[model samples]
Target chain A: MGKNKKITDYDMEQLIGQVLRYGVLTSGIIAIIGGVWYLIQSGAGFPNYTSFSGEPARYTSLTGIIKGLTEGSAKEIIQLGVVILIATPILRIVFSLFSFILEKDRLYIVITLIVLLIILFSMFGGLKV
Target chain B: MNILLFTLILLLGAYLAGLAGSLTGLGGGVVIIPLLTLGFHVDIRYAIGAALVASIATSSGSASAYVKEGITNVRLGMFLEIATTAGAVIGAILAIYTPVNLVAILFGVMLIFSAAMTLRKKHEDALQEGSKLSYVLKLNGSYPTKEGEISYKLKNIGGGFSIMTIAGVLSGLLGIGSGALKVLAMDTAMRVPFRVSTTTSNFMVGVTAAASAVVYLQRGYIDPGIAFPVIIGVLAGAFTGSKLLMRINVKSLKVIFSIAITLIALNMIYNGINHKF
Candidate 1:
């Protein structure tokens, strides 16, 4: 019974657009943070670029820089991979779901759900061959 | 090589690639492969894995919007996917066993071909309807052009299907979106109107990517450290690009992109041939 705001302000497309932008930005931020974290945690020596893979190079090389970043305890790296594996897809599916809702179309929703289920089961079902 | 840092560099690389690829209309995967393998010295296999994830993100984020706008022919996309996915699965298997050198050489050749093709005449400006298969499949559809809705039918269903199969294989083998090949199949071989073919191709790319992505993930080739950044960055960039598409001349940009891809592919070939361990 009071003053009414314009309906245009609450448009669904605007909301969807916000979600799209936010989701993408957040994911990018996470990726950058993860990369930096890996570098500091690895504590590998500063690298040199000259030497290719061999027994060992005496001096720091360019590969050494990248190697320093890559050579970490397997457990820690694997753990990070697992976390990202779960996080990335879930975000994607969530965004995609929102899109389906925005469109108000039921066309591929079932198929998407089933495809997602397969991916989830395959990833986490713990069925090792 | 710490895992986290590897992920970080890959994220940066992908972000750079996405922004650049969008500006150039080359597609993210094309730029990412060279950046990872040549610029950062990442293993080619891992680079391809990351590229595959990025390709899906790029297509999914951008193409979904097009679908919402009702420009994409979803039915056409679904129908063609059966052939593409089958081709993708076979191609993925081949990628795992094919010698790295062969992959490199093939990639190089493709890059050259794509560059030349891009420089060729713009087919959208010259539309010719020829084949009967397009009519049988109802590949003909109308799209919103500036002048209004323009309806066009397909001409060559068989030829188009064959091209889709090849596109799927290339996508699986190289972790690319394979949009160039897809467009060529529809625009040149099938004579489907340009807009319809491109959007439909975009619609199907996600399916193609998923088919091969599953295989790659199972093979342990998909490192999350690499995939996460790529997926995120590319999705964001592609989303932005889709919005800009209505305002830009994507065709002109595509020519430049093709050239860049050629150079990147050449670099990959050189590296693969030289990296004899």
Candidate 2:
């Protein structure tokens, strides 16, 4: 309650430091989770494109790398696209949260809440792509 | 196509993209998109989806450091994110239905513009006063510098927000990191200090990407295989860039690389014009 404790008087650098610490931690956890999920789902094999598989089933072939990722069924590609889009952002959000915590900034808590709300709304909105 | 090999290639691309992109401050999209389309022959749409995911990863990795260093304005970034996110949702929905050709054309045009923007020089020793909106939104801060401490005031919060809306739409639609536009909005339009502007732009980018990412996810654009390796690479690249921030001559690199992006954008437009599938 002291006059010296005004909100405007708080150090920006201190807040930022807290944000960085918590942000990295938050992102690291999400990345670990998402990376693990992707690894598990794709198996040890590379994520192959359905259209590029052809009759030869070439894995080690140099030409196969370009062929497989480029030419895939739209449906399959779309599925992959969505997964990539969602998981990375969540990882980043978790990281940002960690940064905020590291900075000891309460502001990011609210920002995180808003982000959560946006995610929920986006999830439920029934609009794809 | 061997799954293992494709993953390995993407992992290498991601690593290089992260390292080089960060060193140049352009994010990994410049390298990632071409690698996917030209190198991997990825469909533009899928390539964009992958690029967007990687963009989020790069920003997330680096933005945290920038933010902690007092270079990013969390309040300013959060305030503008509202606009960007709203625009992103709308853009993502549009991206799903927009003819692939149109998106390709737009993407190309955006890349050209981004290149032009990147070539501009930074204005130092010119910290302007805060705008009326900045006063209302409380957008102001300081940063450490060789010259000692430099405090800056936000100039055009509303204008920056407006630009962010457009930037968000583009991010969702094209899968390119809208960092250039975000920086322009914060730096030129809003007249925020350079470091603050760049860091804040970085802070907000993930959220912008997230907005579209969710929509893309619902629309089924994310592939686990592609997303995984790309993320791994971009995160690595971003880390490398941050470590080498002091040593790198980012401006010169951006100049050289912007031309590369312009070429890709032109080719993309050509492909879009004659798209088969």
Candidate 3:
């Protein structure tokens, strides 16, 4: 049983590692593309980061990001990459939940569920002020 | 400054932050915050948002390698995430209402704590009996060494969880990984093996950061212009630094870097007190 559990753990770890690596690579590429496009469009514009005005509505929410992406907005594209990067870890948690269930590890499944719920709450539970 | 030049310079700074962060084992988001606020004259909120994004990137990137090594205890990491994710939500919301100067001062203090952590030596505790909670949660795990697989048992689960909550709050508030605090909880408090604690902490940092990042994103704090350069530069720098790790004398480098970070942290505290932000 110990040997079998070790094998299962190893496989799961490998899969999780692959997920993280691919997620990062894909997001990095998308961000670079958006950044290059942005530079070409507004590279010579005077930059202003000194002020504290928050991001516009179009760049803040998930729907807004998707809408901006459909409209081919470079900044929104970059934001899409950022969104994907953030989701990568959450996806790992979701993956862990399924693996725990497969192992019939009830304790871990509950623990993973709690963590996932918290993350989901942060994402979709209107954490906006 | 034009957008091109600003972006270029930010890229260079972030790359160096990542390089130095990985080399020194301090993590990049810590330095990224000060660089943006003090050097680039960016707003503290925006700086934090960008640093959080970069934190997620670096954690996931490095955790991939560590996870494959089989030293990272995934179940243990998930259990601790319960505390960290909750604390992150609270901290992210708190950052919204907290004054920028106060936040800066807090970040400076955290920087000093992190520097002190880096200078401290790591000692692995001898194997101890596992607590009932650890056994029930199946948190005991082993890692492979040249000799064979060495198993370790966890102690003081409650204490470690409590410390992890604090680490999570700091991560959310300051947009740093707070690896120092996480290590203290797992390595010092719980007496987990140093290798396992460090790798597990790496695994958890991404999820903890992601919890706060959602709030930051909804609040319109994550600017693509800032996050883009930071993410790309820090990832590239971390990759390079990992490759360079085998060739360099990291102990001396860590000492030098920690001192530099201490000086920078003092400057941040002074600026915050003066309301320079």
Q: For candidate 1, lDDT tens digit of each residue in B1-277?
A: 6555655676666765665555443457777777776776666677677777676666556654655455665445654665666667667867867886677677777767766765666356424463575555444566676798776666667777788889888888887767778778777876766557666776566667666766665554555445656766676677667767668776767776776777777777786678621
For model 2, chain A alone compared with the true chain A gives a TM-score of 0.36
TM-score of each: 0.70, 0.78, 0.98
Highest DockQ among the candidates is held by which one?
3
lDDT of 2 by residue, A13-129 (tens): 455445544544454444445455444455455444423222132221224423544664222332333344345545555555665565566765676667666666766787742
> Whose lDDT is higher: candidate 1's or candidate 3's?
3
What's the ranking of the predictions by lDDT, best on top? 3, 2, 1
Off by over 4 Å in 2: A1-116
Better of 2 and 3 by TM-score: 3
Clashing pairs in 3: none
lDDT of 3 at B19: 85
Q: What's the CA RMSD for each of the models?
A: 8.7, 7.6, 1.2
- Docking quality level of the chain pair in candidate 1: incorrect
Interface RMSD (Å) of candidate 2: 8.2
Candidate 1 global TM-score: 0.70
True contacts kept of each: 0.07, 0.30, 0.90
